[model samples]
Target: MEIELKPINIIFIAFCNNPKCKNTISIDVEEDTPKDDEITITCEECGNSIRISYEVDTI
Candidate 1:
């Protein structure tokens, strides 16, 4: 049996905007994958939510 693995190069980090609790949000995505226009991350400490938006322009 043979197995192959590829390096993980798709990672992004985001911090919660809640001043009371600033937590790290880690997101993993596949290569060449179309991402969502917006993302929401919740803070584990303070139970706060933060939203991240994305914009794309096709040329």
Candidate 2:
């Protein structure tokens, strides 16, 4: 038996805490992802880790 794969779309914006390297990051996640989830991302330029949280409003 074979399983079918479906594509999911997610939008996330992560900002670096480093003052010298204030970079914005975007990430794609799976379906039904938590809106009020905290995601930790590492900065490539500054090599610092930052946490970001956001909410998704469903209509």
Q: Pick the candidate with the highest lDDT.
A: 2
Over 4 Å off in model 1, which ranges? 1-10, 30-36, 55-59
Q: Candidate 2: where are CA atoms >4 Å away?
A: 1-8
Pairs in clash, predicted candidate 1 = none
Which 10 consecutive residues of model 2 have the lowest summed lDDT?
A: 50-59
Q: Please give, for residues 13-57, the per-residue lDDT of candidate 2 as tens digits.
A: 788778888788776765777666777777787888877676656
- For candidate 1, what is the TM-score? 0.52
Q: Model 1 over residues 1-59: C-alpha lDDT tens digits?
A: 87775444456688877777668887666545554467666777777777767543433
Q: Cα deviation in Å at residue 11, candidate 1? A: 3.0
RMSD of 1: 7.3
Alpha-carbon TM-score of each model against the true structure: 0.52, 0.56
